[model samples]
Target: MKIGIFGGSFDPIHNGHINLALSVIDMLTLNKLIIIPASSPPHKEISGLASKNDRFNMCSIVANCYDGMEVSCMEIKRGGKSYTIDTLKEIRSVYKDDEIYLILGSDMFFSIKDFKCSSEIFKMCTLCVVPRRAQETDCIREYASFLRNIGASVVVLDIAPIEISSTQVRERLKSNRDISKFLPGNVEQYIREKRLYGLGGEYLIKEYKSILSKLLDKNRYSHSIKVSEKAIYLAKKYGVDVRKAELAGLLHDITKQMPDKEHLIMFEKYNIKLSDIELKNKKLWHAISGALYIKNILKIDDEDIMNSVRYHTTGRENMSELEKIIFVADFISDDRVFNGVETIREIAEDNLDKAVAKGASITIVHLLEKNKLIDHNTLSAYNRYTSNFI
Candidate 1:
């Protein structure tokens, strides 16, 4: 059997960590990838670190999403500073007949010589180094050659550099910055739910509201708050995840006020290609840009929430429960006082599907009356939900 060991101080596992792990497992073709979270890293200062259990739980949350990936509390259970040689020795004993591969991030690879029992660590397992930056590839390869000369096996993987760091993630969380793009949705949610990283006393909604207030004008901010409340009510009625619904609603219009140039710049930065219709429709820019902002900057890695934000303005076919809540919430939020709003609100209370159909029909008719272009997603939604009408 081929086994891989990936140990780290996964104080809150982020996308960078996940990307590296997946890369290693795929490249190495390992039978299993054991994720060991360090209880106490010997070489680094352990300031503001999360509790052992919280770290372990966060790692477990991410590991569960991938096959052949498992989290071990060995270092945590050992109750002291974690040493690589000791971990490798323990792992070797378990998989006596199996080949062992040890995965190391760029920092750890560069500083391996300073580690305890470094020579023994090299002999025990093949060292897999993933460079953190493109510029460091040559240096990393040179060092890997040095290791090979000293009878140590080394492999440098050609993976895109992992740009985010745990320290960066902590900094963002400390300042109430959005990290949805940096972390898995569940992991970020776990960090917020547990109030880790000095985020105590400030609830998730309050933090989001603070950030939203800065991004949006007073009217838009007020509308977001109302949408959040309405979404929560609808979530309760529909059995959707209330917090997710609230978050989706609160951030649905995050980039509504961004200028066309800014949105285009963001699209170029993130490599988001736009369809012909999407390029022409400036009104639809917010949903696309806002979802990207939520993912790439705010680092909210929840696809459902991102999609809810992306498609809220133009409802799509086969919308999720949370998506429906936000879509309808936008139409009937307290701030909305347009004609026929009361009827949609009444329809929403009894049947969400009907409310969505009614809402889409209203939007389509309104666009037709004004000779405005209808979004393809809106048309698709209308076709899907109003089949009986046809």
Candidate 2:
């Protein structure tokens, strides 16, 4: 029986890894191909690498799509810098009589001679090299001849090279670019769910839900979720970034439940100075503290998102589309049951400015009716949006 050992960091396995594995299995007629996710790769930096479990799980998802491939936790379980020599020896011990092939990318193939215990590794398995591109073939062939002189058995795979890399995939994901062409659907979904590569996708919503669950009561938590949904809808309608809108809406009321003392403490700690009206208006404290908490404590350094949260309660001048989306979303979220919520919601469907103007007018009326001091920002927001407001 011939078994192929294909190993890499697989930090969220992409389609290129899949392409190489399939090519190797077909070319070698291997009975099985084992994908080993390196826990700590000796050749690469460990920083920004995904957890071993996540890498292994991603490999497993890709492997399950094919007939002859499986994922191994051997290197991950070993818990150290993964060396090819040690991994090949472990496989040799298990499949004593079987032929073993070590599948490698061109980059790793060239550096094989420099690996730890390279001489012993050459003796254990036939090396199967997958070129990174067509141009590297002649260079790799020359290198293979050099390895053969040192008693290494090598086979260069005759297939088109996959031009994708893990680094490219990570970069695309971080910048909110679509990765469907580079990865399997399941693997891409797994990365989004895990929030791997610093992606602000559904996983961020899950994280925010957990945080809100602890900080807010049942109603407020539910309200936050509704606001997030409403914000997504409005963002799509208004051509705003949905991720920013979702985050701003969900966290807009993050500090809403804090008592006056807690709000004061946060204000003091963050060196936030409030106007006399802002200090007197407890209703406005959450937006102020929420913005600071997101910026300073949560360390979300996006100025747009911070401003959206800061002014979600009391709309400010020249608000961005995201800011208006969150402000209107908070007022017209599914959980909002005020007397005029339906009218504002209706207005929001056609014109965001009108909805904001109407919502601000309602807020001002409510504050006045209750003899509450309204924040100046609210007045500025209303003035900016409406032409003829009393």
Candidate 3:
């Protein structure tokens, strides 16, 4: 009996997973396909993940609908970090005589060489990959050659590339938006029943109250409120999403009052890899960690808002309209006073584009003059945005 292995975090199974699995079965004529959920993905911090049991149960719910598909708790039951080689070896043990095929996305295919015992995986099974829509076939062929050179049998299956991704699904779920089209009806219902990503609004409100009640200095809290008000104002001015800008502004300093020690703890817990500058300053970690905390604990689902909060202190490039609004609002809020305060306020009021470009240019020049590392994103923003001014 030929068997296929499909492995993923499967946080909440969606139609994309089902479509990919069916495509593989049809293309490979595999007798059975095992859907394995990882116990813990080594690359990511697990704190943000749904419980292992929850992931497994969701995969099980999706798999039971198909006759040839079965959900395996093998990785979840094994516990600890999951490696593909170990799971493949286990499957080989169970179906000794059967040919095995590993089904993976085109994105995962590029990273195969980095996986634990990737070479062994190829020797044990034929690797079946579906192409991603945006990826070039030439790139796939290049990697396929590299794999073949390493003694791996690579098979590229032709299937309609599903653009749906778990990240998009998670984002949609957080907004209390309809995910029925992206996900299976049952899985969509299950997520709502469990209330997985619905905590953003309440969490933000609670954190705001907590900051007001305890951690924040009165002045800082006042600045936060002003930033929030300005952010909402700018959101209206720019026609960006208003609710997201308000939430981002309100929570931008959620961790500002945390003791340095507590802030560092959150950084470690979130696995936020700091740049050399960020590591040296330590102060900057609060913004990055605060964004993650809001996302994980507060369940903020709007990426634009979360990113705005994260990059508010040190603005980065290609900022969304919302990100730019929050960043500029933080700079020119009524409490702010500086050499260019009046000019910045005028530019902001009359033309936000000029304000953003001027603000970003000022920040870049300041960082350069101070001999500090300018964040690449900030520079990118300046380059893309400054062309209009020049």
The sequence of per-residue lDDT tens digits that candidate 3 reaches over residues 1-390 is 889999988877788888999989888898999999988877767354577888887888888899899999899989899989999989988999899999878879989988898777888999888887745567887788889998999998778777788778988877667777899888776765565655445445555667555657888888888998899899898888787878788888878887888777887887767777787866577688778877898676768878888988777766778888888898898899877878877898877767877788788777778887877666777776777788
Off by over 4 Å in 1: 1-75, 79-194, 197-202, 388-390
Instruction: Say what the RMSD of model 3 is.
Output: 16.6
Pairs that clash in candidate 2: none
Worst 10 residues of 3 by lDDT: 198-207
Reference-based TM-score, model 1:
0.53
Best by TM-score: 2
Assess each prediction's global lDDT (C-alpha) against the native. Answer: 0.90, 0.89, 0.81
Error of 2 at 22 (Å): 0.7
lDDT of 3 at 140: 84
Better of 1 and 3 by TM-score: 1
- Point out the worst 10-residue segment of candidate 2 by lDDT: 41-50
Q: Which lDDT tens digits does candidate 1 get at residues 166-276?
A: 989998998988888889989988888888987753466788889999989999999998998999999999999988998999999999998899999999998999988
Q: What is candidate 1's CA lDDT for residue 227? A: 94
Better of 1 and 2 by lDDT: 1
lDDT of 2 at 279: 81
TM-score to native of every candidate shown: 0.53, 0.59, 0.52
Tens-place lDDT digits, model 2, residues 92-121: 999999999999888899889989999999
